[model samples]
Target: SGGPNYKVALGRRDGLSYATEEAVLSFLPSPTSNVTALIDVFTELDLTTKDLVTLSGAHTIGIAHCSSFENRLFPTQDSTLDPIFAENLYLTCPVINISSTTVIDIRTPNTFDNKYYVDLLHREGLFTSDQGLYEDFRTKPFVIIFALCQHLFFENFVYSMTKMGQLSVLTGSQGEIRRNCSALNSNLSWYAVDGDGHDGKVF
Candidate 1:
C-alpha cells in the first residue's frame, strides 16, 4: 500500500465560539436514535449509514459513566435484563448519587473487541444508548453481525476511520500547525478540520 506520507496543510482561521443548549442537544446522538436519524446526520456530513454502524463499533473500547445510565439501575429497568447482569451493574455503579465518572465495561476496558455486542445480548449494556441497540430491531441485526465477525469488524473500523478522516478536512493553508501539542499559543488559532476533532472534547 503506497499510502502517501504527508503533513497536514495548516493556516486555517478559527471561528466565533458560541454554544446553545439546543445545538449541544442536537449533536449528542442518543443510543435510541434510529437508523434514519443516523443516516440523516451522516448524509449531512457526506457519510453513510454503513459508516455510522462501523464507526460506532469503536465503543467497544471505553467505559460510559454511571450518570449516563442511572435510570436503568434506579426506579425502573427493562425487564429483559438478566438479573446477574443487573446485580453486577449495581456493584460497579451503586445506588448513591455517585459521580458520573464510573467505569461500566468490566471486560477489555482499554482494548477494542466485540464484548460490547455480547454484553448487549446479555442485557449488560451500561448506557441507554448501548441497551437501545438491542431493543431496536433495526440495529440488533447489525450488532449480532459485529459479534459474529471479529475480523470484519476490525476491517470495517479501519475503512470508516479512513473515510471519517476525509470529511470536512481543512488542508492547503487552512489551519495552523501546532508546534507543541499541549501548548496553545498562536497568532491565528487553529480549528479541527475533520470529525475526529471533537473526540475527547466531551463525555
Candidate 2:
C-alpha cells in the first residue's frame, strides 16, 4: 500500500455507549447522495467542502457491495459513468446480484494515493456521491487540485481527518477509556447469564 502515515491525535475518549443503528444511519450520508447532499452532511458535521473532497480520497482502497450502487447501474445506467466502466460493472454485478462487490478505485485498486480523484476525472467514480464532487463547482476545483497533486491530497486529508476527530469530543467523565474496545466495560463479567435469566458464576 502506498498509503501515507501520519501521527493521529491521541487521548480521544470513547462514548459511554454505542449509538443506535438509526442514529448511526442518520449521521452517515448515503452512497447515492448528490454533491449538494454530501456537502450538507459534511457541513453539518463541521467539515468544509475541501475536507469533503479530501476525506473522500479514502475511497482509493475499498470494495463496495453491489447493492450500494446497483441503482446507478439498473433502472438505467448513469449517463455520467464512463461507458467502458459501466459495462464492466454490469458484468461484475447483474440484476439480483446483491452479494457481488467491486473496487471503489478501478485504477490502482490497492493503492491509497490520488487515483480516486483520477477516476472521478475520467467519470469512473463508482458512487454518485463520489463522481458528483467532480462535477459540482464547489468541490471540483479541489478535485482538480488533488488529481494533479497527490502530495496536497495527503496533506489535506491528514488535516481534515484530524479536524474531524475533534467533533463532539467527550471530555473528562463524559465517556470511558475502554480497556478493551470490542467489549463494553459493563460486559466484562466473570459470570454468564443462565437460560432462566439468572447470573451464574463461571467458576
Candidate that would win on TM-score: 2
Write one digit per residue (lDDT tens) for candidate 1, span 1-203: 11213344344333233346898688667654545676677788777666776767667766666666767778775576678877877776787477755444556556677766777777877666666666677678877887788777777777777777666655565553444444333322443334655312221
Pairs with steric clashes in candidate 1: 10-175, 11-174, 11-175, 11-176, 12-174, 12-175, 31-129
Best-matching candidate per lDDT: 2
Window of ten residues with lowest summed lDDT in model 2: 177-186
Give the lowest summed-lDDT range of ten residues in model 1.
Answer: 1-10
Please give the lDDT score at residue 6 for candidate 1. Answer: 32
TM-score of every prediction relative to native:
0.68, 0.88
lDDT of 2 at 172: 67
lDDT of 2 by residue, 1-203 (tens): 99778887766778878889999999888999999899889989989999999999999999999988987898899999999999999998978557989899999999999999999999999998999999899999999999999999999998998898889988866776565676655576764557885545566
